[model samples]
Target chain A: MSSVCLSMEGGSAASTPAALPYYVAFSQLLGLTLVAMTGAWLGLYRGGIAWESDLQFNAHPLCMVIGLVFLQGDALLVYRVFRNEAKRTTKVLHGLLHVFALVIALVGLVAVFDYHRKKGYADLYSLHSWCGILVFGLYFVQWLVGFSFFLFPGAPFSLRSRYRPQHIFFGATIFLLSVGTALLGLKEALLFNLGDKYSAFEPEGVLANVLGLLLACFGGAVLYILTRADWKRPSQAEEQALSMDFKTLTEGDSPGSQ
Target chain B: MSSVCLSMEGGSAASTPAALPYYVAFSQLLGLTLVAMTGAWLGLYRGGIAWESDLQFNAHPLCMVIGLVFLQGDALLVYRVFRNEAKRTTKVLHGLLHVFALVIALVGLVAVFDYHRKKGYADLYSLHSWCGILVFGLYFVQWLVGFSFFLFPGAPFSLRSRYRPQHIFFGATIFLLSVGTALLGLKEALLFNLGDKYSAFEPEGVLANVLGLLLACFGGAVLYILTRADWKRPSQAEEQALSMDFKTLTEGDSPGSQ
Candidate 1:
């Protein structure tokens, strides 16, 4: 079952600007661009935002773009970007970033729900809401599971090793779902808020479309980084790391370190 | 740098149901399910498909869901599923699947534009249209480049090997974009057709929302398959496959074979 084309996987030239950093930087740029565009769409065209008012609904998109999409993307990048950092430090930073994302995302959820209830509008009826709520719920659950299994140190080394791939798979999948959900929300926003004007290429509509494209591009960049076998973190002394007792013997003090 | 945690990446045990087959089967099930759902949506709810009448627009979604989403996904899975097949046969099968996808997708594109022209509905104004068109355009270009580089047998071995990663990256990324655009189109379809009924959870709206979720799950499964390092196509042989004279000396007649 060994791969037949491992050597054909190309390598980056030493003299070239490192591919990983470039992609990481590009992802960050697109991330902030979409977040900023979402903010502008809310502030400039949507009458801005506030707590407990119609404007509060504006906070929802802005916060989602910021917290769920932007910050969440960065959190996933923690290990990749800080590859040389002590694994323990990277794990904490990773968890911390996710905490911030979850908190902010919670506020975004509240903003929409609060607005919906105040206006007597039904909640969770639209596809956008369904996708969004699923993403958020999955995000929370993923974090809880991730923390307990990977960060809390209670898991047996064998178990942790076993669960690692599933964790990464789900993490990557959920991040993608967040991106897809954000795009769904964009369509909902344009149609619900802009209406016929969205069809006429109104500035707000154009901005939102651009935002949607940017989000997909950001997601693609991240996925590209992730799937590039060359970009994966090195298996430092892979055999020892794989050894059943290595984690307990050498890293027991930091039992949960990645 | 090598990954510091390679051993922890985990592997499927021999006793388990072979995971690759399970994921590949699961992806196919989701792909066919969503394609069937799309057909049902268009035929039952959206008035059905034709060439030049108002019903022509129905062809757009149905063909796209089948050709672009389902067939294209299966095309991407060709390498992984046919791992032991003769490389020449697999390459031809891959290209042929894509050719079929392009033709079908082209018909779908024509259906939309023709319908728009007939109805005097402005085209490419909405985010859905913009995203959908972009995906189609890129799909064409990707197919062209992939054929010439990997199927036509004209490129140098070094060049083909180098471009392989980019090809794989773009292919995966474009597949994802196709899925994203479909979700956007679903939102537009629901809003444009269902309007207020969508908010009321009309059957059509609920059906489309389910389709959207299914599309996402299908995309995720394909992606999971794509990104699993364990699932990557093997190198046939390391030094030989990567050797500068690999094709010229050993397999020139099958120069484009994977």
Candidate 2:
């Protein structure tokens, strides 16, 4: 088995398996499946999708799951999954996926707001809404900084090095916040329907709860794969094959090399 | 300024500050304050505390915040805070803190269950309860495994080394689950009283929402400090002062020494 060297802070390699591609791929498939299942739960059981009214509320969960959970996760995994590929290509894919997630999440927010306005319900009223809005706002800022610093017209090598840790920190934080918000949203939706045949123990309620649990599980797995020191992307000699047009590339080199 | 060598896995030291005592202490104080504030909001603003009936419900949040949010966080930080201290002592403190957290959490669970039983309300009837119970169950298992494998009469060195990563991963996962559960419980409590003077926009409702936000922030900060590589405990030269009763002690030695 080929071993990958994990580079911590641009130096000091720790050997782990380079064969994590399959694991990353598997997590992606499982995470996407769970997101799809949650959407189906809403579309089939709760109410069919529609542009306005209660049906519009369904779009909120569906879009948020697809965008925040699936797409954003894929964005984070781009580096690990494409470890052998050119660094520039993986960086492009990461930025692009985040953009897509942002657009979809915005649509999700609009859907919920429209529904609330039609129903004469107050906006930003619940903890779920508050968290959802906060995550979205932070995601936007993260995207902006990432794009400007790492993607195009990148920052100075010193600046990029300083920001790298913060970038990873906030990225993981926002993802966790999204997952937490989704769970709270699901609870609110389920509780609103509770009573009569649709109590918390009923099949529909159970399915919703299971969806929330799955979201948490998916999130936990994704984070484990992302944050584990053993699972970090290996810095190979081939990484230098990519043109060093961006000054920030120097940040990854050992200080002795300078 | 003293620099602590961050030993990843068993070897390869990277120097970072040994001066993180302030950061750790500050986070602990701030985290506990947030937990206390959340509980106080429930007790003082919503309704005063009582031993039986609806008033007894106040004990649930108060105890849960103290146990799951504050105490559990402290348990996770023991290793980092006592990095220079004896490993055995830190491990014992870690386990003991978990035990205290578990006891307080059990009391919190009983408080809610008693209230429900007295009011003839259905049990395990909300997403919050389901998640809360699941977290508690997993926590029990985590504690058992940690105590048996890492503390007294600990497992073989090989086993302990293998289990270290899993222990850290699960510890973080359970803590996040607790925070998520707390947020869901807050939402449920607030919504149940939303139609009356406790409307979402009301002062009490706003305080409740802020408490949920604070819990999220506190969890994020705790996880950041715990997970950051640079913030890991330094393997001091004096670590060898302890008896080599456990074979795992050799793991931290440089590979050349081995």
DockQ of each: 0.38, 0.31
Residue-level lDDT for B223 in candidate 1: 83
How would you encode candidate 2's per-residue C-alpha lDDT over A1-258 as one tens digit per residue? 111233554333323355466677678777977877886797678777887567888888888999998889878877666665667777899999999999999999999989888888778877888899899999999999998877764356566667878899899889999999989888887767764444437888878877888888888878878866655556552345334534344654433223
The numbered model that scores best in DockQ is: 1
Q: For residues A1-258, what per-residue lDDT tens digits would candidate 1 score against the true structure? A: 222222222343221226778889889889888878887878888888889577988888888888888888888887677755556667789999999999999998999899988999888878889999899999999999989876775566767767788888898888888888888888887888888777688988888888888988888887777767656554442333345345554666754344
- Give the per-residue lDDT digits (tens) of candidate 1, residues B1-258: 222112122333121226889899899999989989998998899777778588999898888888888989999998788765556677789899988998999998999899889988888988788888899899999999998876665577767767888898899888888988888888888888988787788999899999999999998888888777656554442233345345543566664444
Top lDDT model: 1
**Candidate 1 to truth, TM:** 0.88
iRMSD of all candidate structures? 6.1, 9.6
Question: Candidate 1: DockQ?
Answer: 0.38
- What is the number of residue pairs that collide in model 1? 14
CAPRI quality band, candidate 2? acceptable
Least well predicted 10-residue stretch by lDDT in candidate 2 chain B: B1-10
> Where does the lowest 10-residue lDDT sum fall in candidate 2 chain A?
A1-10
Chain A TM-score relative to the true structure, per candidate:
0.87, 0.85
Q: Kindly report which residue pairs in candidate 2 clash with one another.
A: none
Candidate 1: list runs displaced more than 4 Å.
A1-17, A237-258, B1-17, B237-258
